[model samples]
Target: MNDEVTRYIDGAAPWQTAVCEKLRLMVHETVPEVEEQLQYGKPHFLQNGDHAAVIAVARNKVSFMVFNATEIPVVKGFVRALGKGDRKCVDIAEGQEVDYAALADILRKTTIAP
Candidate 1:
């Protein structure tokens, strides 16, 4: 885990901080070799030097994105498709109940070596 990434999460609002922490934990648990860094003011997870996932916080929501998500199924809480549909994001609000297991599965699938 990167210290900058930890600081980024620590600086967020309470709800956003919880969401960021959970997402970060999920990424690391799902991909043991994942590398973490603070990039573009957000926590980015990389696998073999390629973007695997990202955790970003906004005023009202926390967004978790899975890169290379073209094969990822549209699960609950996914609010948008990005980067020509190769990335999928789930936006969590203050009281939202996210299925972290499912999100972790997505991360595992998307980040694993072919």
Candidate 2:
């Protein structure tokens, strides 16, 4: 984890922090060689130096974004947000329960090691 990313996560709300941490762990588990840094005010995860995902924390929710997403995963208990191009993000509300298993599956299929 980059210092900037740590600071970003540490400064987030408790719920957001927890979700971000979970996302971070899942990202690493899915792609062991993934590199992390703060980009565009979010925690960016790179696989083989390619943009893979980003974790964003907002006032009301925390979002996990998958870049170059071809088919967005249908995750239970999440609000899907689509951005420009192939980027897709799933937002978890403040008191929402995340489906870590499903998220891990999605990341497993999405993240590329090289």
Candidate 3:
């Protein structure tokens, strides 16, 4: 785990902090060798030096993004496509539940080769 990324999560709102931690754990579990960093003021997870996922926190919600996930199926909590449709994001607000297992499956299957 990267200290900068940890600080980013620690600085978020309570609810956002929880969501960020969960998302971080999911990425780490899915990709044991994943690298973490703080990029663009958000926490970014990389696999084999390529971006695998990112976690961002805003005022009202936390956003989890999967990279190279254009083929990933749309599921509950997925709010939008990003990065020229090569990425997808799930937004979670306070009290909302996120399918971490599903997101982990997507990460396991996604090829972060770019």
Clashes of 3: 0
Q: lDDT per model, in order?
A: 0.86, 0.80, 0.84
Worst 10 residues of 2 by lDDT: 76-85
lDDT of 2 by residue, 1-114 (tens): 799998999999888888888888888888788999998888999987889888988889888888766666544556364754366678889878788887776666677644
Judging by lDDT against the true structure, name the best candidate: 1
Question: Candidate 3 on 1-114: residue-level lDDT in tens?
Answer: 899999999999988898889899988888988999999988888888889888989889888888887787676547477778788888888998788997788788775423
How big is the positional error of residue 13 in model 1, measured in Å on the Cα after superposition? 0.5
Q: Write the per-residue lDDT of candidate 1 for residues 1-114, one digit (tens) a residue.
A: 799999999999998988888888888888889999989988899999999988989889998888998987665546478878899998889998989998887787787754
Off by over 4 Å in 2: 73-81
Q: How much does candidate 2 score in TM-score?
A: 0.86
Query: What's the alpha carbon RMSD for model 3?
Result: 2.3
Q: Higher lDDT: candidate 2 or 3?
A: 3
TM-score order, best first, reads: 1, 3, 2
How displaced is residue 29 in candidate 1, in Å?
0.5
Residue pairs with colliding backbones in model 2 are none
For every model in order, what is the number of clashing pairs? 0, 0, 0
* lDDT of the structure predicted as candidate 3: 0.84
